[model samples]
Target: MEKTSGWRGTREIWIEAAYQALIESGIDAVKVMPLAERLGLSRTSFYGHFSDRDDLLKALVTLWQSKNTGNLIRQTEAYAETITEALLNVFDLWLLPDLFDSRLEFAVRNWAHTDQDLARMLEDADQVRVEALQAMFFRFGYDPDYARVRADTVYLTQIGYISMIKDRPSEPPGPRLQRMPFYVEVFSGRPVSDAEWARFRARHPVAS
Candidate 1:
């Protein structure tokens, strides 16, 4: 057990360096020798942690998902009761995709050859985020299944917009999320009064 834990330390250090390399140089630039150099270790030591570049890359993707999904889940837990606060938590998570620093998502979109583990991580994150949005919609008095479909659409829209920008999010107000509350209002058969719209934007405000 102690022997295994010690090797994981070296692996984690190399994973962290690869993450930084992905951020600074893009996913394609995250090569083994460069990562080893960045970690101030020899390539021989790198091989001690990972068998090859693809192995290290796969580990880095796992670490990225662990951090990203963990934070989103933590945020949702932090604001479990308040619908507005919960929605805010979702936005906070969505606002930082560029920090992943990999165009690998698009690269893998239609390619069946993509890494299965990374694909599964992305899928699971999407599923949990939709679940959070559906929970918010139900609290606002909408049907849960209907809300899940709407939430799915809203998530797709956010992904499209984020892909277009591809940098620090200059997140706009609630209109940036038009279809989200629109899904709530229309699905619940409620009219969105100007006063209520004002309240939503004022209460949410992109970020605090």
Candidate 2:
């Protein structure tokens, strides 16, 4: 039986260290020794859970997929009365960091610039997320082509925000929340009903 190191951090502790390094300094900073040092553990402790650096990297990717893409897909499936309400459900991702980690998303996209495999994974995630949005539009009676276009519009717009917000200081949600009704009208091609806006505001009271 393999002897476990006493006082060494668990797998989650190591992965969280790697996650923070990646978010703060990009992928190159996610080295095992550095992470071990940061955790005040011996380098060998990392091998207890992950075979090597590659294994840890894969775990990070899995975490990103599960947290970011998974939440976005789930939000798209949330119950809503109108297309406007449905879109607002998805928009919760932007306001709720617990739902989606924009810094991690941006970091992974940056990492993908040099990693073909990660690029492919990122592409797959984008396709899956867009498809979820398309399905939501379909539920609201949008035709196929229109749904596709609108889905791309909504997905790309959020992605654009993610990219633009990278490296910038965090901003208040009020500005964006104030403009949400207009965004809903434009994205859904219909006015946001007062009830829908009220519900959305109640769901996100920080901006109120």
Query: Compared with the true structure, what per-residue lDDT tens digits does model 1 show for residues 1-208?
Result: 2444234346767777776666555667679777766655678888887889989877765665666555655655554344444454555555345433224344333222355765676787778866866666676666778778767765676667646655666657445566555643443445555554555566446642
TM, every model: 0.60, 0.94
Which stretches in model 2 have alpha-carbon errors above 4 Å?
Answer: 1-5
List RMSD in Å for every model shown: 6.9, 3.1
* Cand. 2 Cα-lDDT: 0.91
Q: RMSD of candidate 2 to the true fold?
A: 3.1
Ten consecutive residues with minimal summed lDDT in candidate 1?
A: 104-113
lDDT value, candidate 1, whole model: 0.59
Clash count in backbone of candidate 1 = 0
Report residue 71 deviation for candidate 1 (angstroms).
2.3
